[model samples]
Target: MIVAEVVRSGFVESVHHGIVALTVGKSFGDVDSPFFPRSSNKPLQTVGLLNAGLVPREEADLALMSGSHDGEPFHIERVRAMLAAAGLGPEALRCPADLPLGEAARNAWLRGGGEAEPILMNCSGKHAGMLATCVVNGWPLESYLEVGHPLQKALADAVSRLAGEPIAAFGVDGCGAPIFAISPMGLARAFQRLVEAEPGTPERRVADAMRAHPALVAGTGTEDTVLMTAIPGLLVKKGADGVAAAALPGLGAVALKISDGATRARVPVLLEALRRLGAETPEIPEVVLGGGRPVGEVRAVW
Candidate 1:
């Protein structure tokens, strides 16, 4: 297990546990064990959207579909337009709505006395995409969140194929949507295919969209977007409760799940994973305090 300690106000306040490391053309510990992917399943779900012809073939909104956005006004507006395009409304969204994560955006909304709209929810784009799929495939808008739904079944099959494993479990997401599980290695393999997928394929389209529109993929500033923007050809995705993955085409993939559930350490763990893969970037600076002092370091446990 990997231990990530959090230091605040000059003291250790919390710790997050997880298994994080790089595997080179091979699976790491318990990579075969199935685990629910939560939001990490976004890219796989997009395949259904593509296959059903609900979304444009040349477009890839994979990043937004998988993103936990900051709820910027622009993000909210786009989500709204997406829903409108699908002939749906905010009431149709199963995900909870909230303000953007960015202080500027949140405060601005407050200053304007803007109430939280479903579109402002970070998962709004994902929900909108799902609704669009339902419209395109003539699926019922009601109970679309059900596991047995055709759209969901297709998504599950796509996930299984990408992970090279069968779905092992199911759960409800915070957004009131179905969630599927796969092993750590399975998760890694899914990401591996995402980056290495054949060009023009659904998987590759998602990758390309994410690569092309890093900002729209998340928001003005978010880890997933920042990492992709900072590095070339590095496909990154973040999930709830400290789950994250990074895949480099031909190099391999890395998946992390924090045991203690502290998500604050996600960025550090991801940076460590990148380091293990022998990839370098300037964003991963050592943890430091106000005095320019090294507070605590993020070291790989593998």
Candidate 2:
């Protein structure tokens, strides 16, 4: 379906085609197409870590472990603490070094003459959690990201179980960790399991921690943070290449992907899907900008 239209000078210039998957009722577009969920699968990976005996000191810590943090000061401090708890440091992380994802933090880092550091990477917390799991299980830390590694295999199993589907393919993520491909329906199923998991279970624990510390899941203006804040008990996560998923416990779940990989098209389609599911969502602008001025708005066509 043409979920979003881009206009310029009162004329439609482009359209975005996408799919929306739901846990119940009818779905739109190609929900069965296999695609990489990217970082959106972090929660399931954290579940694997938990199953491997990784015990974080706080629920917020678990949230951070499942987060693609913005590399703010608080986020960095938490990652450092996680590493410290496992008797490791930034040097132990396998993810490549990168600048902060938050605009303000990036500007500050540049102003202070900061350079790329593994701790500043968005996936640092996940890496820290993986290291902690390795420490707890006495597994080899150096090859933790390798596909044949015990940790990666465990993660694969957890993802398959939660998604209710076997991985169709695997690839390396931007952070060097393994990524798995599943249908949009499978992705929605995983999130449904996450939000609807019984209380006191590891799945529910991760969801609760994320809902409790939404800021840790993403940055201030990020979609996940904004959506979760606006709708209590809602779980939202976005991945690279225009993929996103959300689940309202005991209500409904949605997963989507834009064909052109435009991140801007993601939220509008998601909001529309949620609305169809009878969810109350905050008003979000779908404006397109030109020269820092609003020139158009994206609207869902179906």
Candidate 3:
């Protein structure tokens, strides 16, 4: 489906094709087809961690455990804290080292003469949380990222049970953790369940933590953080490869994947989906500039 359009100089120069799943009316594409949800799976995996006996010293730590955090200074501090609390170190992380995920942080890192390190990876928070779970269970921290590991198995079960659908496939994520494939519809269903689950349940704990610490879940000025912060009781998570999922406590839920993997199209389409279910969303700009002036914009075409 052509879900969004890019205009430049008052012309429709391009369009974004994608699949969208909504809890309300008609879906835009093949919602039944399976695809990797990427970091959007973090919250589900966090629930699995809690179920596996992982406990954080502070409830806010759960937000980082389920976050795809920008590699900001605060983010680094928290990841290190999580690891130190588990009697581990940055060496325990298996995710590839990378520059900070946000442009401002990346620039600051370069100015500070910093090199890429595992602790600086955007997913290190999650990897650190995984290590903490292993410590709690005396599981082999070295093999923690293996798909066959007990932790991963429990995560798979959690994802399956929450989605009310069996995992269609399994693969390694960009963060080196096990990623499960499920339908877009299933992803939406899983997010809805998280928001609606009773308080103190593992599911609700994940939702509440993310909602309460939106900045930890992403970073300052990011989409997920902005959405969750601006709209009370809303949950949002974006994944690599153009996948994003969101849910309102009572309104509805949506999941989408842009076929061309364009992140720019995500917010417009997501807002459009939410509007279809009668959500009031902040107006995030998607302007196209030409010769240092605004010329056109990206808008959801549905």
TM-score of each: 0.89, 0.97, 0.98
The sequence of per-residue lDDT tens digits that candidate 3 reaches over residues 138-181 is 89988988999998998899999988899999999987888999
RMSD per model, one decimal: 2.8, 1.1, 1.0
Model 3: colliding residue pairs:
none
Q: lDDT value for candidate 2?
A: 0.89
List the candidate numbers ranked by TM-score, top first: 3, 2, 1
Q: Supply the global lDDT for candidate 1.
A: 0.75
lDDT of each: 0.75, 0.89, 0.90
Which scores better on TM-score, 1 or 2?
Answer: 2
List the lowest-lDDT window of 10 residues for candidate 1.
21-30
Pairwise lDDT winner, candidates 2 and 3: 3
Deviation of model 2 at 112, angstroms: 0.5
